[model samples]
Target: MRIAVPLPGTMWAFDVISIIQIFDDDSVMYGSSDRPVIDFIANASSKALDHGMSIATTALRDYHEKPDLIIIPGFANPHEIATDRRTRDAKARLFTADPADALAIRDWLVASHREGVEIAAMCTGMFALAWTGLLDGVECTTHLPFLDDLAAQFPKALVQKDRLLTHNAKQRIWTSAGGSICLDLCIALLAEHAGQSLATAEANMLMMHYPRSVATRRSDGAPSVLPRPSRQSDEIIALTRRVREHLSYDWTLTTLAQTSHSSTRSFQRRFSEVMGVPPSTWLLTERLNAAKELLELTDLPMQQIALRTGLRNADSLRKHFSAAFGVSPSRYRQDFLRTELRPTENV
Candidate 1:
């Protein structure tokens, strides 16, 4: 595969260089001759980019016929970086990028996309992609801060805030929540070209887990408390999946124990040994975690949340939620939760 990166005048330097390095380093780790070739292209060679630097690029001479994939890199946020006026001398041009440059990039991207070049965009780089009208009716994501803007700017495009990456093979477009997560997009592209094992090995070499496979509407991606086993106990794993799938089930200690093929007393003892907490404690924690997730990701009424979490009612959930989080559900959602388009008011 030949991937072309269009270095527009407003493109972020880090987004360009880091994505290049990720592919290069992982290709080395992949240790294969059939690796994808990445090309850095420019609208014109030896031009200054708006993010305080200049670059020279040439590989894709004619946008309509050259590359298999095209990457649009995110640039510095003109509004945010301009706050410290005295120190941001190099990036001042970002505040007033030429209208012609913007329109030219959009037109070229639209043409290239029409010619069957798969496109990947990072963060605000999506604006150029969206401007071509190709993102209409397509699901996409960008930086969390730009989620609202992307939605507002392109009303026909679906904006997903919680998702780290989105790919629509039909449109040949891929968008990602930007920043370092751009590398996650790189790894995913690597996995697509190579295989999951190469992706897994590349991720392990980077000392990071593969970001996500199928994304849920979640913002809670905290690190695992337990070290991941290379091979998990199938019984425990399947049991855990079942419990989560039906968290509202009225689970008695005896019923859960029987699922593990042990007496209640023996199960409790082994469960405590394995999880470092009593089984009862684990149940409560899981229920509360479910409740908290509902609070963050949805505006579901309190009684509905309680039912899904197995707390059975608003009264039961409030009692446990207050003790564990030290705040009301409304307040927690207000403080931490951001919806795909807007934050929820008290529900």
Candidate 2:
């Protein structure tokens, strides 16, 4: 399948490459060694940036071969530019007024959809796609910080507040949240086009645990673990301890209630009363917290950690991680490791 990626000044580079790599893998089920081909083209009007940075053109005109997918990567903000006023102003003009890039992308997206092509956006690229009006009435997600802005700007679109990826089958438009979640979306796409095994292999090659579905929520407003009054509350704590001890076990409300010597209704009530959330919600959070600790201190593969933490599988763990931290397991580990190794500033 051919995928077209339009480049705008300040587009985040990693977002573009993550999508490209999945389709480029020749060993995958969807890929063919003989005819495995994926194409990327930068659709920008001028190849030269006024700031002295040069961008190459894969195609001079926007109309080339129709791509099966078109992508727009997130852009750098105005505040991030350190160049002179002229360069900054030029960038602003290019982005706001130069409809060449946007129009070309819009035409390709509309045409591709008419011919059964898929259009996707990563991070803030959702803004550009939303501008095309194709995402109207479609469910989509963008970077969390921009959720409010995207909703307000495009009231016609259904903006999902807490999702790693959201899609509207009607529009065939897919959007993903933040940077690392872009990789998750690509893996999911690979799974759909190829098969579960190929997706798992691709994830293993990248050292990424397969990502979870985007519907998971990080918070259920649970209470802290400190002591609370009452005999029932203490029993709830004991049940929590048992849950933690056997995280790999399939825990059900009846199982927990039986272990705690309480009815399901009583267990649910007391657990929620003491923890400020349902028992199941508390258990999931505990598992996720334990997984985070293991990720921080140990170099265990995500699948092992998931098994140890009682998550259903690696994909489920990634879903929780993405929802809780907005990053994949590997990226979170690297980031934590970097912070841990950083030299301490003298206080």
Candidate 3:
């Protein structure tokens, strides 16, 4: 079965292209696996759109021939933007606005649905799908921050926010959560056609781990590791959870041992044996992870990041961040922003 992805105006270049690359770059999949090819189509500026992006594709001679699946990639919907009243207001409007691009897309998608195509929308793209009126009287979801907006705008639709992915079997439509869930959506899609084996292999290749399905509550509040042998170490798990909750607090070995209700020697041995790392090393790694996430996901200053991750100061943030990522925090943020899909006022 074939798939189609429409490149509408204001589309996040990264969101659209990541899905494209997943299917188009079969070389990344297993050597013997069968993968379906996806078509990318757009109406205007065949060569260009938001973020100065373009793709090469052959114009389909027919619109009546709907592909088996239509994957609507997400658009960038940043929580913050430059601090100008007009720009901020415009950015706000464009995020939820039903622009001409979305209206046109709605019309086309409604028709494709009649042809029995399974439709999937990622992140804010769900807003466009909702505009089609097809989501009315159906259970759906979108980015966590915009769940209220989606519900208010489409009162007829049952918008459930807790889910990372929502699939209406009757409608054959799938909606995935925002940001990184695109990877989750892609992995699930590939698993649908290819087998779990191929999807797992692709996840490993991409440095991502696939969930059981879109419906499963992911145990991904933190980075994951091999499963513990039994639930007896629930106390240690509880202690670790507390550490994440209070990452910035000054934590010492004595305090950690007391928290775990064990002697310093016993606590260090148990933590190392059960969690695969000593408490000190694990704490350092967690701090480094927190700093890295802040750098990649936010525009927060180094001092703020240091304070948040318990690094204590900007210098420490730089020293540890650079050691872990091989780049300073500013350089790392610049490299991330270059590829990140910041929603466009026009898109």
RMSD of each predicted structure: 15.7, 13.9, 18.1
Tell me model 2's lDDT, rounded to 2 decimals. 0.65
Q: Candidate 2, which segments miss by more than 4 Å at Cα?
A: 25-36, 44-57, 60-63, 78-97, 218-347
Q: How well does each candidate superpose onto the true structure, as a TM-score? A: 0.56, 0.56, 0.55
Model 3 weakest 10-residue run by lDDT:
80-89
> Per-residue CA lDDT of candidate 1, range 163-192, in tens?
778888678888887777687787766654
Better of 1 and 2 by TM-score: 1
Among residues 3 or more apart in sequence or in different chains, the pairs in candidate 1 whose N, CA or C atoms overlap within 3 Å are none
How well does candidate 2 score on lDDT at residue 311?
Answer: 88
For model 1, the run of ten residues with the poorest summed lDDT: 338-347
Which portions of model 1 show Cα errors greater than 4 Å?
Answer: 26-31, 47-54, 59-65, 78-101, 214-216, 220-347
Model 1 superposed RMSD (Cα): 15.7
Return the top candidate by lDDT.
Answer: 3
TM-score between model 1 and native: 0.56
- Could you tell me the lDDT of residue 261 within candidate 1? 91
